[model samples]
Each structure stands twice: as structure tokens, then as C-alpha cells.
Target: MATTFENLLYDLDAATGILTLTVNRPNKLNALNATTIAELGQAIAQARQDGAVRGILLTGSGEKAFVAGADIAELAQLSGPAAQEAAARGQAVFREFETSPKPVVAAVNGFALGGGCELAMACHIRVAAEHARFGQPEVNLGLLPGYGGTQRLVQLVGKGKALELLLTADQVKADEALRLGLANHVVP
Candidate 1:
């Protein structure tokens, strides 16, 4: 089906029964701006409702990031209420993926930090390439993950590991992430 949303960069091929949704803004490392988040939500909803699609793959457009995080430029200007609304919208979108009936896989080829990491965690399964890196560095920016990161990370790695990662605001390599059970599979 043809979609009006261009920023999301969706490619749905009927023959393969695979729907691929790519974060198109490689220049910005495919950061989750309001528009990108909206488009992503729409795309996932469409895919889930479409009967032909058996599986969905979410990925970034470039090798730099699966999604670096939220758009810091846009987020930096938000006031109290605006920030709250942004968080709410993000939560709703990510929740759609988490509860999606069809299987969703995240192909993490690079940096998946903050919201990026949360995005991957929302998927049914995650496959990270050798070059992929994951982290919850929101603390460094004087913010916490506003998009389900705290709960999901704790569920995957337990409270101790989750707290260490969140508190330190450190990046974990793919191997370490797999060892900690943060990733389902790590590939070269």
C-alpha cells in the first residue's frame, strides 16, 4: 500500500511478505523527532493491520545509527508541558510496537542509544551487528529515558544491571549487551 508519509521511508514488498521500515534521516542519525515518531507509529499500525505482511523489520538508513536517540535540537527547546506531551506521544507509539501481534525485529547495525535503545527493546526480537552499540545515556543529558526504557531494561537485564547502565550513562558493546541478555542475538 502506498503511504503519504515520506520521512519514514517504508518499503513493503508483497512477494516476500516482509515489511521494512527505515528511519530515513541518515544525516541526523535518524533521530526521533516528532514527525519521525508519528510516521513510525503510522507505519507500524499499517503493517500490523495489513494481512500480507508476515514480519516487520525496523532499521536505520545508515551505518551510523539504528536511531541515535530523540532529536536533541527539537527536544532542547521544549517547556514543561511540551516535554510532557512529547513523552506521552513517544510512549504511545512505542507501546504500539510492544503490543503488536505480528512479529517485529530490530536490526541494530550501529549506535542504539537512549530512545534508540528503547525502540529496539520494544520489538519482539533484536539482532545486532558486531558494530552495534547500545546504551541509555539520557542521564548524561540531564534527562532519563521518557520512553519505557527503565522498565524494559530492568525486565531484560534485571534491576542491578539496568541500574548500573542507567546510572553510569555508559555504552555497552554488542557482546557485553548479549552477555547481559540485552540483545537476543549478535551478528558479525
Candidate 2:
């Protein structure tokens, strides 16, 4: 069966009990735009509903990033209601992945910031490359993470660490992330 999606940047392949989902917008550093988010939500929902897919591996197209963050341009134009809707959509999509019966693994290559870090946390496991960096820098942009970051960060890394990271808005290296139990494994 062929899958339909609005964003060509995302590539989904189901095979051998694994549904491999790739964020294909390398030129944009695999940023999560609205269309990409919608497609990802649909793809993940389809995978959850499909009996053939036992596992999901989410990664980026190139070596740059798993997902840098949300599309800043799109986010830059949102008002109060529009921003709320956007956050709700992102939460719903990430929640779908989080609650899925099948396991989801994030193969984080490089920058997994803001919503990207939240996305990784929503997954069952995360495997980061040696160079991978993680953070929630939304505060720097005069905003906070709208995609379950506030809660999930606390759950994953504890209140103190979560607070520190969120307040400072600094990126953590792969080893540091692993040390804090943020990332499961670090690949060379």
C-alpha cells in the first residue's frame, strides 16, 4: 500500500517489521514544519495501526540533525490562539508516539533541540551519535516548549536538571546527555 502525505521531505518505509521514518529536509537541517509534523503524525498513526510494523526507527536524512526544532518562520507568525493550536497538534502527535504499543527509537545524529529534544524524549529509546547535541532553547526565543517539553524533561532528567537546562538554555553533549539519562546509547 502507498502512503499519502503532504510533505515530500519525510520518507516512510515499512519493511521487516520495522517502519523506518526519515526526516528528509536536509537543507533545512530537518526542521519540523507544520506539514512535516502533520505527515509524521499520520505516518506514526499508520504504523501503530499496522500489525506488520513492530518497531519504528526515526532519524534524519543526513548527518546534520535528527530534527533541529520547529520551523521558526511558521512559529514566528502565530498569535495566541494559533500558537495554542500548534502546540496542541504537536503534543497530540508526540503523545501518539509515546503511547504506542510498538517501540519507537530515535536515532539522533546531531542537533536535537527544542521540540526535537521533546520528540526524542517521547520515543521509547534514543540512540545518539557521538556529535549529537540536545537542548530546549525555546526560552531564548522568548517562548517555552509547547510540545510536552516542560513535563517530559522533568520526567527524564529530574526536576533540578530539567530546571537547569530549561533556564540556562544550553546544549548538552552526547556524553552529558547520556550521563543524565537523557540518551540511552551513544554511537560512534
Candidate 3:
């Protein structure tokens, strides 16, 4: 069965007990805005509470991107304190994967930049499509990845690679990401 939320599409497989959550904003490449992030948190909470759901597979709508990044328009409107709070809220939502008893996996179909990359890092396992790209490019906007990117990236790819990627703001292709230990597997 499937249920559609404002910014998300959820489907559950009774046979496999796998719940798939799709960020449903293909027009925007499933950009992470406050509302979308909140909706994701709600979905996570719901899945955690439902015994029928054994695991979650997180992905984005469309073939072009898993999530391009945060919504620049929405992000640009935040004040200093507002920015801090927003980051906290986003981090909290992503952190659910770590605390949840059920595993959360990320299916990176395309671009996963900034908060998108951060989201992938939160997953217990990550698999990327052949054309997928990953990066933390917040530095281009004079900001840093505030949604656990620093810590998670370090943990996944090690400090040296993490620091280099952060400093360069360079995107890595699926093969490179897998080779660097950023992605567990790559798919066609």
C-alpha cells in the first residue's frame, strides 16, 4: 500500500516489510526545505512506531537527483538564530536513523549534494546509481554543512578525504564515492 504526503510518497511492502520513502519534489530535485524536512521526520517517526515496518529505503523522486541540496530560496531567508535552529532541526531528523531499531538505507539515484549528501551519510547503508554524484558544496554559498555532514562524512570516508572534499567542494562520481568508502555499493 502507498500513502502520499505533501512532500513525500511512502509505500510499504507487506511481503518484505520494507517501507520506501520518496522525497516527492522532482520539480525542485527534491530539495530539502523546512517543510520537507519536517515531513520526513514525521514519516520516520511513523515508521518507527509501526511494527509492520521492518526497514526503510529512502530515495528522491525523479531520475535526476536523490536530493540536489537545501532549497536555496528558503535558506536565504533565515536569520542568524533561525539558521542555527534550522540546522538543529535538520540534524535531529537525520539522526533518527542512528537511534531507530530498524535499519535505514539510502538509494542514491542521482545528485546528492549538501544536505542531500548529509542525508545519505545518515543511512546505515548507502547504494548509488551509476550516474549519481555526491558532494558537500555548501562552501560555495559561504556556509558549511550543518546537518551532521562534518561528523558523518569523517566517519564514512575518514578525516583526510572528508577534509579535502569539504575544502574543495568538489563532487565525486558514484565510482569514486564507492572507492573512497563514501558509498557502500554502486548500481546500474
Q: Identify the candidate with maximal TM-score.
A: 3
For model 3, state the Cα shift of residue 172 in Å.
0.4
Q: What is the C-alpha RMSD, rounded to one decimal, of candidate 3?
A: 0.9
lDDT of each: 0.91, 0.89, 0.94
lDDT string for model 2 (1-188, tens) is 45655553333455467777887788888888888888889889888988878888988879989899999998989899998999999999999999999999999999999989999999999999999999999989888999999999999999999999999999999999999999999999
* Per-model RMSD to reference: 1.0, 1.6, 0.9
Q: Write the per-residue lDDT of candidate 1 for residues 26-129, one digit (tens) a residue.
A: 99998899999999888988988999988899999989899999999999999989999999999999999999998899999899999999999999899999
Stretches off by above 4 angstroms in model 3 are none
**What does the lDDT come to for candidate 2?**
0.89
lDDT of 1 at 30: 86
| Pairs of residues clashing in candidate 3 | none
Better of 1 and 3 by TM-score: 3
For model 1, the superposed segments whose C-alpha errors exceed 4 Å read 1-4
The TM-score measured for candidate 3 stands at 0.98
How many clashes (backbone N, Cα, C below 3 Å) per candidate?
0, 0, 0
The numbered model that scores best in lDDT is: 3
